[model samples]
Target: MAEVRTKSGEPAKTAETKRPKRADALRNIEAIIDAATRMLAVDADASLNDIAKGAGVGRITLYGHFDSRAALLRAVADRAIAQSDRQLATLDLEGDPRAALARLLEASWELTHRYGALVIAASQALSPEQLQRVHDEPAARVRALLERGRAAGAFRDDTPIEWQVTVIQAILHGASTAVYRGEIAAEDAPGLVRDTALAALR
Candidate 1:
């Protein structure tokens, strides 16, 4: 086995040798993204200054990572998609397709509720083209779940997959808004969304 040496002249472990830590700017970007997500959860209208304050960085530094609020939102969307991708990967769809569909909806509603303002800001403020990669592409995972349910005869044969996608995605969006506005409890939203999806699939 070849022993790797670090810049410090010490033996480099396998993990560290294989994948180095994130660059300074990348770490800062991730910190800012996390701060922005927290701020958005509390204040959907949080400004760049607000996010900067949350991250304990100057507005200029925040801008260095993201040129504009829309740009920041896009980055945030990418982060969300990355996290969501992990969860989607581990899901087992072998059970009842309707139950699986319900689980999918519940998971989406939970994610939306947890990241409500970020979703709202990204959808409304960021250009669709900018969010296409993260926002649009990741939705294909959800569509796959719906397709599986359809193939299993759990979903209505007449229902279009895209229609189901649109409906479920739209409801989750609405549920997020409702949670942000305090019009509905976040805990209740998932159950309601699951019920609605079950009804629609019938």
Candidate 2:
């Protein structure tokens, strides 16, 4: 996400007199995003008008915020990814490597399952490169964690990090699909993925 910042490297402050309007705009944006996320999860083809109504905003307001359906969908995807990034950032990255991997997997597993519908829908509607970008940062973090594990002799060193990252992510995505399809119950998914991924790493 682009930060609205000044040359002094601080977040650009809203004027005192305009703060209320700024707050309203932020609230509307959040409302739109929240409403759209729920709507798209239920029906991938949900209309913009429906989203606007759900958000208690008008069509013009929605359009003013997102401009187009594709843009809104991309924002949905980006917001989800950004949220996970923020939550994952709070985890201890310097702890025991295996424990760190478990922490990461559990966090990712839940997110993948929760956002399964949105992820599937967005991938189909958005550009290929945009979808790839959504996956890239998580994959990089996974790669770094695996490297740490390998260094600690907690995971196999022979396997390439790239392949490990790919397979781990593939497994998480597959587990998420299983949850959405009712093949694996949602509550059971994280543990299943955690164990399977640990086996692969070990």
Candidate 3:
């Protein structure tokens, strides 16, 4: 074949040549997200200019990436949910049900605690439908694990799986809320929350 060339008679970019720009773009997006998450968590009323300054970017750059504050908040929520799913995915689903469930509980508790402020801010920005859509992925994973536990005779079968899972979720959420509200110390939270979830489920 003849040598490839652009319409301008210049060589086209190879993958190596295109990589750095793509990497920079990814870094900018991530920076915007990280800054937005931190700022919004501290102040729900934080302005776009404040976020852009925190991200070390201009207003045009922030808008170019996120479009709107609500859009940015949704992105933050999506990220938290995605991270939670990834953490839950790391558990040994085929292992002992209680052990696996405890792993999930511990992982999820740590995640929620770490993102507590952001989660609260996102909850205010997202509607019930939007909230459920973003949250459902992790919940489905938990449901599947619970189902597996029930099938393996680890969980009580007297109550419907739906009820049991709802209670389990409530307990986790309540535990995280307690941690956020100063009802429970941060150092004491993980074990206390894990024990509470184990007792509720088992």
Best by TM-score: 2
lDDT of 2 by residue, 49-108 (tens): 999999999999888777778778888888887787888778777789888888899988
Q: What's the TM for model 3?
A: 0.78
lDDT by residue for model 1 (66-94), tens: 88887788778767767776776677656
For each of the candidates, give the backbone clash count: 0, 0, 0
Residue 89's C-alpha lDDT in candidate 3?
A: 78
**Which residue pairs does candidate 2 place in steric collision?**
none
lDDT against the true structure, per candidate, is: 0.73, 0.82, 0.75
Model 2 whole-model lDDT (C-alpha atoms): 0.82
Q: What is the C-alpha RMSD of each candidate to the true structure, in Å?
A: 6.7, 4.2, 6.4
How many steric clashes does model 1 contain? 0
Name the TM-score of candidate 2: 0.83
Q: Who is ahead in lDDT, 1 or 2? A: 2
Q: Which ranges in model 1 have alpha carbons more than 4 Å from their true place?
A: 1-23, 124-127, 133-135
lDDT of 3 at 56: 96
